[model samples]
Target: MKNGHITQKIGFSALFGCMLITMFFLGAIIYFTVVRGIGAISWGFLTQVPRSGMTEGGVAPAIVGTLYLTAGSILFALPLGLACAIYLCEYSPRGFFVNIIRMSINNLAGVPSVVFGLFGLAVFVKFMKFGISILSGSLTLGILVLPIIISATQEALMAVPHSLREASLALGASKWETIRKIVLPSALPGILTGVILSIGRVAGETAPILFTAATFYSRRYPDSVFSEVMALPYHIYALMTEGTHPEKQTAIAYGCALILMVLVLGVSAIAVYIRQRQRIQNA
Candidate 1:
């Protein structure tokens, strides 16, 4: 027993050490980004359009585009993903067909981002003639995050106690009614957590958007879903890799990265607040 206790202590210490190291690296990234990017952030930077080959002016277009894309993707993915989770968790039997679907979802979640981009290009852009518009990009991103949301929501739904279902049925409630009134509310927090994670992933994706929706430089905000738009991730990539004015453009890239990070974090905070409130009310 003493030897086992000592071994457990060593294992825990190693795990904690690894966690700290991971956090330290993350902190370093944020610290460097802030140090380099703070000077470029201002009202003008946030609200003006890029000019002079993107060496002057602001990133307002990118900001608006990113918002549009993120919102569109969420709108497209949320309901579909939730419905899929519900079917898999509540309606489907544990058997061969369900197993195949679960396996496919897991595989899809592991597919590379660039592959989604290519698929989007082929299907949405060429076949559907979306032509590098926000709609195509959003649909691609929605597909990319669908598996994540479905997996998260399924886990959440499954976590609802089986006894709750049994008691509801015992009280003469139908399965669908019980799920709607009781299970859904109980599982909301976990579902929100999944949504938050999906938002983060969708917001940061460059590859999928690059071929489908993002432009290297766009002067105006997108007027419709069919319009091509500037996104922060693609904008940063362009500035760092394709711009002639490296000094000024690199600073702007850093600033864009900072803005993107803050945007994601802000969304995550709101989702977390909602989830916490849900848990409190449920409790």
Candidate 2:
């Protein structure tokens, strides 16, 4: 018994140590980003366009472009992904083909972002003749995150109690009605979780947009979907790799990273808040 007790204690200590290490690394990243970037962040930095060959000025265009791309990706991906998930969970027959399709989606989710970028370049940029534009980039990102959304949504839908579905159908509601009125509502929180994750992924992705949309330096803001705009991730990369003035651009790059982090966190926090409130209401 003493030996068992000692073993349990050691196991607890190891798990606790791992948790501490994870937290330490996370905290270190946040701390360094803030410390290095905060100095460059200001009202002007947030609102003005870059100036003097991107050596000086703000990242307003990049911020706007990121927002545009993120929104476009969500809009493009959500409905289609949700529909596919619904069909899979509610209608797809349990068979070899269904399993194969599921496996394909899972594999697609694991595909490299760079490969998606190449695909976007070939399909959206070249074949479609959309050129290097926001539409092409947004579509590419939408496709990139589609697998994630579909997988999460499928899990969420499957998690809905079969009994609840039966009850809704038994109450004279049609299958579609049951799904729309009961199942979807019940699974919204989980769906939103997928959205939250997708937003983070979509916002941070540089590779997918590199060939399809991002331009190193664009003076004008994107006026339409066809416009090639500056994006934060690409902006930071350009600053670090291609800028003439190192110190200033480096500071600005850090600042851009900080802003991107904040944007993602802000959006995610809002999603989480909504999810929690939904749980409370449902409870």
Candidate 3:
């Protein structure tokens, strides 16, 4: 018993150390980004267009473009992923084909972002003739995040107690009705958690947009889905690599990074808030 106690204490100490280390790194990144970028957060910096070789101006266009892409991606991915997960978890029979599909989706999550960029270039940009627009980029990002959504939704659906479904049916409720009313509400928190993770990824991705939608510099803001737009990730990349005035562009880049982080964090906070409320109400 003493040996077991000592081992358990050592394990707890190790786990606590790991958690502290993870928090430290995450906090360090946020601190560094905010400290470097806070000076460039004026209203004009956010609301104006670039001028004088993009050395002087705000990132209004890029900000709008990133928002468009993130929203578009979610709009495309969520319903499709949710439907697919529902079919797989609630309707599909256990079999070799289902196992294959599951494995394929798991493998897809591991595929590199750059590979998705290349695929988007070939299929969406070239074949579909989307012409380097927001539509193409959004579709690419939607695909990139589909696996995550599907996996999360599958887990959430499965986590609904079997007894709950049986009880609903015992009340003479149809299968679809029980799933629609009972299962879906119970799983929404987990679904939103997946959405939170996807938002972080979709907002920060540069490569897929680099090939599909983002322009290095645009004189006009995008007015349609077909129009090319300046996005924050590509804007940051361009400021670092393509601009002549390094110091100013670098500052702007950091500012853009801060804004992007804030966008993701803000959305995530709202999702987490909703999820918590849902969990409490359900409890």
User: Which candidate number maximizes TM-score?
Assistant: 2
lDDT of each: 0.92, 0.92, 0.90
Rank by lDDT, highest first.
Answer: 1, 2, 3
Q: Write one digit per residue (lDDT tens) for candidate 3, span 232-275.
A: 98998999998689998999999999998898888778877877
What residue runs in model 3 are displaced by over 4 Å at the alpha carbon?
A: 1-22, 278-283
Q: Give the TM-score of candidate 3.
A: 0.89
Candidate 2 lDDT for residue 169: 88
TM-score of every candidate? 0.90, 0.92, 0.89
Q: Which candidate model has the greater TM-score, 1 or 2?
A: 2
Q: How many backbone collisions does model 2 have? A: 0
Q: Where is the poorest 10-residue window by lDDT in model 3? A: 274-283
Model 2: per-residue lDDT, tens digit, 44-63? 99999889999888999999
The positional error of residue 219 in candidate 3, measured at the CA in angstroms, is: 2.9
